[model samples]
Target: MTIRVLIADDQDIVRTGLTMLLNAQPGIEVVGAATDGRHAVRLARQLRPDVCLFDIRMPLMDGIEATRRLAGPDVADPLPIVVITTFDLDEYVHGALKAGARGFLLKDAGPELLSQAIRSAAEGDALIAPSVTVRLLAAFADSQKEPPTQPVEPLTAREEQVLIPVAHGRTNSEISAELHISPSTVKTHVAGLMRKLGARNRVELAMWAHETGRA
Candidate 1:
């Protein structure tokens, strides 16, 4: 299936570059482009694309708020969003994730990683930039004075096994192969983990893993 994408970036060159790069990939199409966050949100709601690619520093709203409006916890039907930014500032990373962005990447993450992030988001998975994943999560974890919330029930041994790789940003297929389980089973465990941990998405689950020192 072709993955339809909506891109929001203030810079003309960056938007054109990304649109071209993604359009070149198999099974991916850049369906729309917006110059700012408000327009992005409007187009996204209208287009209902498979995924949204947003830059952090757009005018008239910014990507973080745009993401929150479309994919935040309050939204009954949250759309998949991937935030790409030139800055790797901890605050930006934190804000995007907290705003319900499924994936986060540095603008320089290159074409392959960028495509992978969009695909992952469309598949209900997530990918963070490898360079910033550990540092970003660690900083967020450290900033929290309270202990990580315990799961409503104890995790199974398999669930524990699955959590580590997920926190490390492994895809479901990767985790499935590593744990000698089927992809369906990996997804099942991931779902259970989310429910038990009160996590809204994989990103939150990853953060919980870091907070609890499981990652």
Candidate 2:
């Protein structure tokens, strides 16, 4: 099945570049483009693409608010969202995930990683590929500690086993191989762990995992 995508950004050039890069992939296509947050949200709701790529800053509504509408807790059915931004700071990255973004990526995160992120989002997997995930998220994650007020749920032994590699940034296939389980089984376990831990995506799971010394 083709992975449908919607691109939302104020810059025409950036939107065009991303659309072109993703379209070149085997099973990916851009369904539409939006120039601002409000339009992005409208197109996303109407089209229901496999993934929505949103920029952080835009007129009428910013990415954060758009993210909340599409994937926030209040939404009856949340759509998967990947936030693409030039700003790669902790606050934006963390904020985007909190607002329900599945993945947070930097704009300069080259074509390969950009395509990979879209594919991952469509697959219900989280990605913060090297060019973006490492340079931005890693530095922040390494420096930060767990929030004092947040108490995480306890994990089962199987969940702990599953989280080990995910916390270290391994892909589902990698985790499956390491755990001697099928990819589908790995995905199921991942979903279960995510719900148990109240994690938005693998990145947040990783943070909570390491904080609990379960990594």
Candidate 3:
């Protein structure tokens, strides 16, 4: 199935480049491109794309607020969003995640990583750029002493097997190879764990793993 995407970036060059890069990929389509956050939100609600790509800094409104409006905790129905930005500051990462962005990537994360992030988000998984994954999660995990209020049911052994590497930032394909399971099976396990743990996305799952000392 084609994964439709809407991109929001203030820079004309960046927006255009992302459009071209994503549109060239198979099974991916750029449904709309917005020059600012307000436009992005408007277009996203109208287009109802499968995934939304946002740049952290934008005019009219910032991507963080836009993400909050579309996918934050209070929203009745949340759209999947991936935040792509030139800056990888801890504040931006934390803000985006809190605002319910399902993925985060650096602007220079390359086409392969960008594509992987889009696919992962489309599949209802989260992907953080490997460069920022460890540090961001560790920092986020360190700031909070209380256990997450999300996880209710305990994880099974098989689920525990999957959780460790995922917390370490392993992708589904990598996890499948390491566990000698099909990629689809990895996905199934991931979905199961997310539901059981009440994780909104993979980043939250990773955070849970760390917070619980399971990683």
Candidate 4:
């Protein structure tokens, strides 16, 4: 199945470039493009694309709020969103994550990273740009005043093994190779961990690991 995408960026050139690039991919399609956050929201509601790509700075509404409306925890049926931005400012990154963005990337992260991010989000996985992952997450981790609540269902030893690598932003395939497990098995463990930890996504899981000194 092709992955349907909605592009939301204020710049016409950037939007056109993204549309052309994604549409050229074998399993991806750019279904709609919006020049501002409000229009993006409208298009999202209308098109119901598989994933949304948002630029942080936009007229009428910024990507942060757009993400909140589309994918925030409060939404009953949240859409998956990936925020792409030129500025790697901690505030923007933090805002996007807080607003329930499944992926975050720098604008110049290259086509490979962008494609990977979109695919990850479509797969219900989270991906942060590697260049900024450790530094940005570590900064957020330091600001936490309290650790996550202990889960009613405690993590098993095997699950703990899975959590460590995942906390460091390892993909299922990477974790599988490291732990001598199959990718499907790694995914099962990851799903179990997310359930036990009450994490909405992998970033939250990673944050919990760091806050609890388990990472």
Candidate 5:
């Protein structure tokens, strides 16, 4: 199935480059492009694309607020969004995740990784750039004034194994290979982790893993 995508970036060249790059990939289509956050939101609501790729900084509104409007906790039906940014600042990462982005990537993430991220988000999985995943999440956890919330129930050993790779941004297939388990089993353990940790998504699960020093 072709994954329709919306691109939102203020830079004309960047937006154009992304559209061209995604369109060149198999089974991916750039359905819409937006120059700013509000335009992106409007296009997203109207197009209902499979994924929305947003830049962190934009005029009129920022990607974080745009993500919140479409995918925030209060939204009736949240859309999947992946935030791509030039800056690797912790605040941008934290804000985008808090606002409901399904994935996060640095602008220089190559075409293959970018495509993978889009596919992952479309498949209800989340990816964070591996280069920044460990450092940024650890920093966020340390900077939190309040202690990380404890899981409702302790994680089983299998679940603990799954959490480490997941916190490192491995996909289900990757984790399954690493742990010598089936993808379905990996998914089951992921779901259990989410339930016990009260995580809204894989991103939150990853954050919890860092917060509690499990990863």
Candidate 6:
């Protein structure tokens, strides 16, 4: 199936660049583009694109507010959103997640990563780049005593081990190497972990890990 996406960014150049790059990928289409946060939300709600790529700053409203309105836990039925921005600040990253972002990406994360993030979000996964995640999360951790409140649940020892490295932005291949397991095994463990934790994607898993002081 073709993955439909909506791009929300204020800059014309950024919009054009993202649309062009995403359009070039197979099985992906830029269904709409919004010049500001409000329009992004309107277009997203109306179109119900598979994924909405949001920029943090925009006119009329900010991406964080728009994301919350569309995808927050209170939204009844939330759509998946992936935040895109040039800033890599911890506040922006954490705020985006709180507002119901499925993933966060640097504006310059490049075309390959951009494409990957869209597909991942559409598949109920998140594609956070390793480097950006580490810094963003560490800063978030330092500023908090506990992560945002989530339901209490027990996790296996093996899952706990897998969860920390994921918060540190380790990929399946890296986790496999660290735990001396195959990548497929890591994927299985990840899926199991998400199910147990009620997480939509890796980003939530990592966020919970950090929130729980495990990351």
Clashes of each: 0, 0, 0, 0, 0, 1
Identify the leading candidate in terms of lDDT. 1
lDDT of each: 0.91, 0.82, 0.89, 0.89, 0.91, 0.84
lDDT of 4 at 154: 76
lDDT of 1 by residue, 116-214 (tens): 999888878888888778786767766889878989999999999999999988988789899999988998999999999998767678889877878
Report the lDDT tens digits of candidate 2 across residue range 42-154. Answer: 99999999999999999999998999999998899888899989886778877887898877788888887777778777877888655544544456557776462243566
How do the candidates rank by TM-score, highest first?
A: 1, 5, 4, 3, 2, 6
Deviation (Å) of 31 in candidate 5: 0.9
Residue-level lDDT of model 6, residues 31-116, one tens digit each, is 99999988998999999999999999999999999999999979998888999998878789779888889788888888878887
Give stretches of model 3 more than 4 Å off. 140-151, 180-188, 191-200, 208-214
What TM-score would candidate 4 get against the native?
A: 0.88
Deviation from truth (RMSD, Å), model 4 = 2.3
What's the TM-score of every candidate structure? 0.91, 0.85, 0.87, 0.88, 0.88, 0.77
lDDT digits (tens) for residues 1-215 of candidate 5:
99999999999999999999999999999999999999999999999999999998999999999999999989999999999999988889889989999899998999999999998888777888887777866676667888888889989999999999988889987898999998889989999999999987776787888777787
Q: How many steric clashes does model 2 contain?
A: 0
On TM-score, the leading prediction is: 1
Q: Which regions of candidate 2 fall more than 4 Å away from where they truly are?
A: 129-157
Please state every model's RMSD to the true fold in angstroms: 1.8, 3.0, 2.5, 2.3, 2.3, 4.2
Report the alpha-carbon TM-score of model 5 versus the true structure: 0.88
Model 6 — TM-score against the truth? 0.77
Worst 10 residues of 4 by lDDT: 140-149
Which whole-number lDDT from 0 to 100 does residue 68 have in model 2? 94
Q: Is candidate 2 or candidate 5 better by lDDT?
A: 5
lDDT of 3 at 108: 92
Q: Which regions of candidate 1 fall more than 4 Å away from where they truly are?
A: 144-148, 210-213
**Model 4: number of clashes?**
0
Tens digit per residue, CA lDDT, model 4, 31-92: 99999999999999999999999999999999999999999989998888999999988899
